[model samples]
Target: MKTYYIKNALRVLLGLFMTVAGIGHLTFQREEFLAQVPRWLPTDPAFMDFVVLSSGIVEITLGLLMIILVKHQAKVGLALAVFYILIFPGNISQYVNEIDAFGLDTDRKRLIRLFFQPVLILWALWSTGGWKYFLSKVKK
Candidate 1:
């Protein structure tokens, strides 16, 4: 069916996006990206390393899960949405602390990234059937 193909297409697109992002985070220890986290953030070097590795692994896993497995796809999508929400505070901290340690030079660019945060969240929710699931639960 057309609908089925569309759904798969959307999932694949999202998966590819995440996969590439994770890979970048893993491979590019770019100073620009590292500068975003301030020195006073109480982030231990080991912990930060673990975070980087785990985040990449999680992203890769989720992409594979969404693309390779046919069943429980919606649940996997929901989990990915939750993961996006969980990482939101990091984005907030960057904005609130004015940590331009990242290459973002202007407040405008930081604010723009903040806007993008929710868009990604909403996209994940919609892509994963969270909205439909919520509606079904509400109807019941």
Candidate 2:
């Protein structure tokens, strides 16, 4: 019971973090986020802005749904995990291209941050019982 509550609290915290991150993508930190957009993508300013804006919207929606869709959390968590996977290339690009953003100004720091992506994936799954949900589906 206590563990469940802890997970719930962590889930909510993650939701809040996502919400704020989305807002940053669209607003004050827009330029910073632009740095993380893969350089291999079109460098056209408008297109890059569009990518950031659209992702921000998705993040906001997912964050809200994560908080409100408690009964469907496993599904939501799975979706969030997939979203993280989809965006992982941006992190990889940052590392490979040696771009600096969000205070990760060094190769070592950026490389270390890359490893945290898996942790986020695991967090999304574990906090919402998504691991069990995935396993149950897979075994069928």
lDDT tens digits by residue: candidate 2, 1-140: 99999999988888888889999999999998898889889999999999899899889888887788999999989999999999999999999999999999999999999999999999999998888899999999
Model 1 lDDT per residue over 1-140, tens place: 78767777888788888887677667874334444444445688766666666777788788777677657666777778888776666666677767674555677777788787677766655666766776677899
**Full-model lDDT for every candidate:** 0.69, 0.92
> Candidate 2 at 75: error in angstroms?
0.5
Candidate 1 residue pairs in backbone clash = 35-101
Candidate 2's error at 76, in angstroms? 0.6
Colliding pairs, model 2:
none
Judged by lDDT against the true structure, how good is candidate 1? 0.69
Provide TM-scores for the models. 0.78, 0.97
